[model samples]
Target: MASNIDKYKSDLQKLLKLGQQLYYAMNYEVFEDKFIKNIRTVMNSDEEVTKFIKDLPDFDLKYQPWYSESLVLIKQLLPDRLGDFIKYYEKPKNRKLLESDNYTIEDYLQGNIRNQSFKIATSVGLDAALPQFRQQLSILQSIQARFESSLFDIRQLVQADFFDSELAAAKELLKHKFARAAGAVAGVVLEKHLFQVLCDHHIAIKKNPAINDLNEALKKNSVIDTPQWLFIQRLGAIRNLCSHNKINEPTPEEVGDLIAGVDKTIKTIF
Candidate 1:
């Protein structure tokens, strides 16, 4: 009896010959219809073909190109049945190819599999990182809320002092100066906190880095140097003005600039 491999090879050759005849001889309509109908009758009579047909993935029953169609039919006939066929006919001939030796087949397969696995892992890692980013954003928002609350309270206190005996007894000329001094001090504190929070979030400079060390690090990670950083710096300056009581009312332009800076920094980091 012929081995399974020999049988498969013979069938494949027959299939190829039929295809060539159809392509070159232009007798495909006649040959394919009659030959395929006869083959189907034979296949239906054979237990092996019955088994093969049962293993195929769902496909239109009327589709032709018999060799490819037969392979799918065989697969559907027996689930995971190809593994046995592969082991018998497709095992690597070179043992060195099975071993991970330099440019061997094993090494190539390993590299391909590793790359596929890494793509899956990277996708999962990005999904996991999103929640952490949201948490960091929430913390920054909380800091902003606290800062605003503190500034409002300071403003109220400064306003109350206008009616205080100390301010009332003072010359009218020094009253404006006193209010400005209070605002300036509040603005400085607010700026300091903004800087501290950014550093805490790892979105700004390291707190204790020496100037030289910082410069060297920046050189290495120069891509991190961004317009967002400049925006944050400008926002801090505006916060400083408010905290220090230099201006009783900050301009809308200053507030908008500060908001834009914070937004840019958040977007870049996350």
Candidate 2:
């Protein structure tokens, strides 16, 4: 699966590629009717956006009213990046720039207005009427960095929730007097949670991590103390004993200890 960063990069790259193409087409004076259609496809929106806005108040207005909503897919797939892109995109545009001679509908109707339009787009958007390329790039970079950190936090939260559910299921098993079952469940949860924490921190571990391997890995990474590591290893042994009847099954008290240890580790460190 592709990461969110990859998708965000793709979206930004697509926009830049389109912008460059448009620039070149205007610069070179491409075909007459086709470039008009190309510009329409690129700039003019045929899609309606206002339907997403619910419960708009009904009122009479003397002046023209404008309303807009962005494409839903853009925000959903590239939520963090696109959201911040939209937010601060026009901040520098609020500043004034030296006014250029205004073009009318007549200017657009005349041939060879592509250069004029391209010049305007390059300097400043028509609506905003100001140009700040450096500031725009800086803001965009800051937004991307923040989006990355926010994605990391979201991963942590999702892992935490999954661990919470697994731990609770193990306790419920124990409540039903399924001591052996509870020990195995708690042990599995412990291993999975530890692996998730490692992933959250971008730590690489061996594939199909074992409990003892995880315990040592956690300690080596300063994720747990030596005593806690040893305790976790013992819990792994309890899980092994519970799994095999050749060794005596773990008692309820032993299983309770397993659950308690897992719970404590989750609460304190996770």
Clashing pairs counted in every model: 23, 0
lDDT by residue (tens digit), candidate 2, 195-251: 866775567899888888877888898967888888888888887777766558688
Q: List the residue pairs that clash in candidate 2.
A: none
The 10 consecutive residues of candidate 1 with the worst lDDT sum are 121-130
User: In candidate 2, which residue ranges exceed 4 Å CA deviation?
Assistant: 1-152
lDDT of 2 at 200: 54
Best by lDDT: 2
1-270: candidate 1 lDDT, tens digit per residue:
453334434554564444343222222222535544555676746666445344433212222344243343233222234343233222255432221121221232223222233234221121222232233223223323433464423332232232232222322312344433333433333333334334433555666643233333433455345553454446556655555444456554554444344433332331
RMSD of each: 27.2, 16.8
